[model samples]
Target: MTLSNTIRWLGMLAVIGGICRLLMTPLELMWGTDNTTALIIGGITGSVFIIIGTAGIYLFQAEKAGVLGFIGFLMTTLGNILVCTMVMIALFVNTALQDPQILEQDLPGPIVPIRIIMMITMNLGYILFGIATIRAKMLPRWGGALMILLVLMTFIPYTDYLFAVVWGLFYIVLGWAVWSRSKNSETKVSVTQ
Candidate 1:
């Protein structure tokens, strides 16, 4: 429907996806075996999260989002797509071929560079996006600043999941802000009309 609605829904998806990701480790532990199921769930949700989250961030005020925001969206989205594709392949191999050992093997030579690029792009892109969001002033200042800070925080040991949840919360807040603004604007227009 409206751009605000789209962003709201996408933000919800990001939240759900983040929760799914956070569950992966615990689920694997409970199952006490293969991580195939967890990987599949995480990969699917993670893909949705990254793609939609990037779009919501990029389109928040596209005209004012700036070059860094654009680059951030492209890099993060592409990197997530690549990583998700690899995860899907892993799922297929584990399920169809019943070969978990394949995953243990070192990635092929060609894939190594791609993995490195994905890591750099996904991390750097989000950082830039956060900065751009702050500069654009489309969302709350603290939300944007938190985004940048959370991304940086991921580098700390044992904080990946913690920051991920916070990141998802940021999306939720941004989505609510956009949705509320749109609703208020619509109400004002109706009254004037």
Candidate 2:
């Protein structure tokens, strides 16, 4: 298949991924950020879809995105991989903790550091990527801005469900941007052919 088709497929995946997260909003409202079944399932699956979408977005504008966007893409991709690991562990660990024998509230010692790193890298990655998107002018500035702003908005006291709503919206917007880019790319490729 041509590169344009590949990107279009990725954009579709991104939208599906965003929808997966969007559906989780109701689950989170009912479950409240715990390692419930819905979160565990959604988190891993959505992360996988988003990761592909992540690469697609960058490839969609690589030339225009430049060095900054490259770095941002790397950081965000790595951060996303880490999220899958963390989420998986959270489910198993939470299950074990529920028994009468376990008392710990968090993951083991080494994981604490890893989790911290994940947050730092992901946030910084989003910021850089967002900046690159704005500079590249290939996609909407708000998409990039949302990438940065969403993390910053977390400082406010939003509940689990509310955060899920906002987070879902962010991904949906990103998917729209990617979808748009892919369509434009297809048009260009076809016109040239």
Candidate 3:
């Protein structure tokens, strides 16, 4: 597929991944929940999101996107990968297999630093990326602004599901924007021919 088509599909995948994250909140409440299943799903979705987010950053024409976009892409992609892997290990191996109570307790010393770093990178990176996207003017400004807002919402307590859904919506908008733009470009090309 062409680059535009690839970006469109990746954006769609990101939307789906965000939806999966929304589902995870409810699933976690189920009694005798299968952590393994959650981990597998989370890992897959997170991977998809990472790809789309990373690609989205670079897909913005480099000259216009600037240093902020590049930094955001690196941090966002790396943060997602690192956090997803750590979460899987924590939930599946550390808490599920070893001690269920571990989830209730504070993070262990080794895990604390990782969590801190992940939170900063993931949140800050997305915010920067959103700003960069808006600056680049390649996608809808509202979509990029919404991305920044959604990440900010994650910091609020008791709003996990709400933010996840909203985040998914933002991704859906982004995907639509990418897909429609590609389609429009193709139409223009065909018309010119």
**Each candidate: how many clashes?**
0, 0, 0
lDDT of 3: 0.64
For model 2, how does the per-residue alpha-carbon lDDT over 71-186 read when each residue is reduced to its tens digit? 99999988888977877776666677654223244656788888888998888898999899889887777878878776787676755566555555666776777787677556
Q: List runs of model 1 lying over 4 Å from the truth.
A: 25-29, 32-34, 96-105, 160-167, 186-193
Best by TM-score: 2
- Candidate structures ordered by TM-score, highest first: 2, 3, 1
**lDDT tens digits, residue span 1-193, model 1:** 8656676555556555555655665666666334776776666665667566657556655567767878877876887788776777777878888877877788786667877787787778778777788887867877677677776786778774465456556666665565555554431111121
Clashing pairs in 2: none
TM-score to native of every candidate shown: 0.73, 0.85, 0.75
TM-score of 2: 0.85
Decreasing lDDT order of the candidates? 2, 1, 3
TM-score of 3: 0.75
**Local lDDT at 167 for model 2:** 55
Give each model's whole-structure lDDT: 0.66, 0.74, 0.64
